[model samples]
Target: MSNSVKTINPATGKVIREFETISDQQLQDKIEKTHEAFLDWKQRSFDERGALIRKVGDLLVENQDRLSKLITEEMGKPINQAPGELQLCQGICHYSADNAASFLADEERDLPGGRALVSHQPIGVIFGIQPWNFPFYQVIRYTIANLMAGNTVLLKHAPNVWGCAEALEDIFREAGMPENVFNVLYIQEDQASQVTEHKRVRGVTFTGSAATGRKIAAAAGEHLKKTVLELGSNDAFLVLEDADIDKAVDACVTGRINNNGQTCVAAKRFVVVDAVYEQFRDAYLAKMKQVEFGDPSDENTQLGPIAREDLRDNLHAQVKESIEKGATCLTGGEVPDREGYFYPVTVLENVTPGMPAYDGELFGPVASLIRAKDEADAIRIANDSVYGLGGGIFSEDEKRAERLARDHFDTGMVSINGYYIAQPNLPFGGVKDSGYGREHGGFGMREFVNSKSLMIAQ
Candidate 1:
């Protein structure tokens, strides 16, 4: 395997920088150092760990602009969205710093003879395998929670965003954190299994494709180590017959085009009731076409290039195959003649279950519109996917919408009359093939730690 780390700018398809990859011995040393740090770090009081995490939050805020720019240049995210992602990173850090002590506090119970207590303890060194999309936010989501719980981190970032990975290490150092408390491994893909299987790495946290997540989970299981997998999603946007057509159309446009429609939780499937299907489709198509696509650095540009060229090609192929297989393209279907990896914001109508785009997650600026006969049909279509990550219900009647959200949508999270977005205070994860384990809120902090139940002899 090659030991070279090349940074390519996806926006322009140019080489930004190339660095020497870390050797096997260097990776082994990193594991050793992280283990050593965990020994002493876990003994520290919760307040101490919280203080360190708070410092991390402060550092993120101080260097948001620089970090955001690096992210934009590395992966072609919208410039405006880059700062927002940085703010999200800061918010997660602050959330963990402020609440981890309380979240992880020992719970004392009354026993027949004596008192029993349940404690949340750190699971030693945590291995984080983060993806390129939302690079900083994804890493911080796992790191802050685990570090606040008194565990050190070993981060194996996506190959495309190596600069951002290095910058993160610098931020931790600037915050006065111990050197070994957080380490970044510059290993090639071939070495991922070896690094994840290290004995000291007690738990694994991964956010990526289902295929890769399964492989990682299997490796972690082989070593008897716990793992948390946050895989892909084909989230649905359901519009009821009694819904406000304008509001539903607006939400669908934003949900499908945001982040160039590369988000795991982006609304890939749109299930709309027949009563309002025609109006909603027309409005949604117009809005999607009006979105300006250009350089992400331009403030007026609503959509930016896809993260990578391969992703753009894959999305284009899916769109072509869907159209060839009988799905009608309502808005876009071709690549734009632009400098970057740009593809037109696509909208497909009459999408059936067997179509290529309908069967798989459309990880681009393409929206699949599937008409439903009624509430039951809408629910049936929404729940027909292998992914059960997130979904949104649009309806005029709040009570009815809440009922559908509770009973019909087969997802981990549901939004009534709103677009799907995760907050730090709420639990986020999925069921079925979307992967297991939760992130954010109290559940996120506990995912990287061990819950020890104590019993007393009567």
Candidate 2:
């Protein structure tokens, strides 16, 4: 494979930096160094690692704006959202630092033969394959938790966000972290599999498309290595007959258009009861139209360009195909002839299955509105998909809302009267093709380690 890493600006499609990619020998060296560091680092007290992670959090706050700007330049996330992402990263670091020690504390277990205990141990060097959509938070969510649990990390980040990857490495170094505690390998597409197959890489943690996740999982499985996969989602937003139209519309707008509608948990399918279908559609489209799209660096910009031109083109094609297939364009669907990778926030009513927008993950500012007859129909429509990452329900009837949110089929998370929020205290993941394995909270921290059982006789 070619040993060249080209950093492209998604907003303008310009090459910002061309980095010399790490050669196969260099990757092997990094794995060896990380493995060596893990031996000593894993033996250190949890308090030591926790203290360093806390320091890293402090560094994040000190440089939040600078880092946020870097993300905007690299991936075109709205300036407002960029700072929030930085803050989220800082919060995760702090949370991991404060709670990982207790989470990893050995637990006494009762067994038939003798007294036993379950202990968490570092699994050596972890290989993290993160995406560019959430350049900083995605990496931090995996890196902070893994490192806090006594494991070192080797990151192979997406090509578009190479600068963000290097910035993360610099943050650790600036926080006085030892070399090899966190190593960012500048990788070419062809070298990804080889890096994951390295002997020193004990496990893999990946966040990307389902196709890529399958390949990584297969590689890890072949080596008998542990892996955590966080894949894509075609989340549903079900609005019941009793739901408040005003609230439902507001929440749907935020859920669909946040990050220019590039989020995995963003509501892609809108299933509304026929009783208030028109009311909800009108309100939702009004709010979507009000969203301001401009340069990500603009503080007032609520929606920015889709991260890449290819994504924008794919989204445009999906919207066009949906319209051609009898879906009504309730609001924005056409791309303005602009310099940046910008597509208008699009809303489609009467979007049925078999259309491109209905069948696939629309990773842009596009939403589909489908009307259901009753509660049962709504539930059925929401679950009529292969991707089941998350879903949302809005209703005035509290009991009905709870039942729908809790009993939804195939979703990892469900929200009532609100959008999906991935907190450090919660277990975040998905089921079905949305991918398996959880991240965040205790589940996330433990993903990089092994739970070893020890038995002792009296």
Candidate 3:
């Protein structure tokens, strides 16, 4: 093992652990072993695999405290949020185990000339590159589904949360998963291309920025391996004339500030119709002002430090530049003098097209508010971006909001009168630059599987 990945305590800016990354030969060996493992694992009945998957879910719930603590310490997620992330990950296990068999079962069809069957078969080892935010859920979101489909997985998690990565791998092993069925590669980002190009690696899935996603997808495409990319998004939360201001504000605030506002699908843009823009603005500003930043380990802390100093600086730079380009800082723009990487909860108004806050993802505890002349303007403004991951529509008339969200909103996922990012039973991913392919629900289990047509009658 060569010293490479350094896990840091984001809350204290201290080194927690340094993992020795494996050599190229060792990585190749693991990929080969995972492929070998897949051969046997795929032969097991769905009931057999489902039973083991259920046990893994039970273990996750059973060890929630320790696992959640690891996430909170490694990445500065407020301790209160960590348990929910774990619970969501555990839900993925349960959902995948319960649904994979039916989702992937062979379909018997009647044809004009002969009978045919469609079978979902395992496609060897898939390589996953996950992000730092929502450490446990990010990995489990795709991994558990792939595993349930009988394809082994190799995870290349974010650098700052190495401990969470190892702990996840260990948990699966402890649950009696086959050796090398799920492995963690403590490799550098640069080394990822090699894994994609490896002959034994069947597919690759990544969750990160568009620039990085382009590179990974390119490498995987060159190898003719299937790829799933879940990149960043600047999702908009729209408040129409008839929206319930109190409820919308609460949901948008949670979407913006939760997990210290580092989520890929967090509601970054707030587009409100002119009729109630002022009312929404006042309430939203008041709530954001009340967010307290402190040690994430404290249960009462609503906001925690950004995962790293560089990330905090990047977020600040985006806010500063937006200010320079005519955006007004409504509140919480100034950087406070503090020990950890703490940035104030900022809200930028009068956000125009050219401003960074309007055109791009903030990726931190910053919100952008854009006023629209009417309902038409609100929908127009919401769709004006390169990203289309997730968005929300808040209105008292649920039917109208649902219709607009279904017909007009150009994003991959939308919530009516609320905010949501991940659900075990829903398909998760995005369109355009936000990345392609769907995960969760039944879609993820078949992402890397071989759907072959089995003809029966002569």
Candidate 4:
């Protein structure tokens, strides 16, 4: 495990730097030290924790330019989006700091015999497994909330963005976090098992593929430990007959292409009712085809390379399979003869059940177009998948559309007449194959806490 950790430049496919994976002894030491920190941290007042957390947010804002550049270099995120991502991280920190105390404050409950209070108390050290797509935002969403709740955190970020992981540890330390209150485990996947099984670790939160989430959950389950698994999604964006075509088209394009189409919540499937299918098809196709990929460092570049070569290969294979299974490519499908790990913006039509592009996630700049017979059929088509993470409905009547979104949409989150992503004050998670548990909003602060009940004698 000594030379196993490598951070690669996804845009150029170059070796950025290779680092040593910490030994079992080193990992054990980190675990112990972090556990020790949690003992003291758990006793601190919410005000004290909130103050420090706000400082973390301030620091992120101050360092946004530098850190954002690093994010782009490491992950091929377009320069314009990198700063936005960091700013969102700053928002998470502030949101957790400002609202966590109230969110987790002791609640007085009426008891039959005596007065009872439900207190949210820190459980212990929580381990996090984060992905690289939204490098800083992903970690901040979970860690900030937990920190405000007085739980020490351990993060094992994706190897491709290890630099960002280490930078986070430094940021926490700079913001006056207690020694070992936040830790970055420079360990591989196998080493993670050890961390999960460690007796001191209380809960685990993972944001990545469902396949990996299963492994982490199974490992933690064996110890009867709590786990929050926020996995992948193939979110459907439905275009109803009455939807504003102009608004719907723009939302669909942005929803699909944001984050180079690597986002878990990015709309992967477009379920349009037949009334406006042709207009939707033509507009979506033209806009999608116009997308261009260039150096992420370029401010003018609208799109960048996929995170890695294998990811690009996987996306192309999905497109190829969909085509072979009778789906027609409306736009970009073939891999471009480019230097970087890039795939052009693609749109597919005639996508149906059983095809990869239809049932599974494409995970790139590829959009699946599924036709529905009508409004009822569109809802059915949207909810026809195993994933229930996020979906959208566009309609002229906001009230009626919201009803469909609230009552008919089976996804954990839905949009009425627009697109949406993770918001700091909103509970973000999904049902079904997208994984279980919630993050963001106020709920995240208590996810790893012990909600102890205290009944006082009258």
Score each candidate by Cα lDDT: 0.87, 0.86, 0.90, 0.89
Distance from true position, residue 150, model 3, in Å?
Answer: 1.1
Error of 4 at 72 (Å): 0.7
Q: How big is the positional error of residue 282 in model 2, measured in Å on the Cα after superposition? A: 0.8
Model 2 lDDT-worst window of ten: 1-10
Question: lDDT per residue, candidate 1, 1-458, as tens digits?
Answer: 66798878877888899877887788898898999999999998878888878888888878988887898889888888777788777788878888888999999988787779899998799999999988888899888888888899999999889999999999999888887999999998887787788888889999999999999999999999889998998888899888888888888888988887888888889998999899888888888889867887766678888888888889899889999999999887888876778888888998997886788888888999999999999999899989999989999999988988887788899888878676888898999889999988978888877788898876
Q: What's model 3's TM-score? A: 0.98
Q: Alpha carbon lDDT of residue 345, candidate 2?
A: 83
Name the candidate, 1 or 4, with the larger lDDT value.
4
lDDT of candidate 2 over 300-358, digit per residue (tens): 88888888888888889889998999999987888888687888888888889999777
Query: What shift in Å separates residue 217 of candidate 3 from its native position after superposition?
Result: 0.7
Error of 2 at 149 (Å): 1.6
Distance from true location, Cα of 324 in model 1, Å: 1.6
Give per-residue lDDT, candidate 3, residue 127. Answer: 94
| Candidates 1 and 2 compared by lDDT, better number | 1
Candidate no. 4 TM-score = 0.98
Off by over 4 Å in 3: none
What ranking emerges by lDDT with the best candidate at the front?
A: 3, 4, 1, 2
Best lDDT among the predictions, by candidate number? 3
Candidates 1 and 3 compared: the better one by lDDT is 3
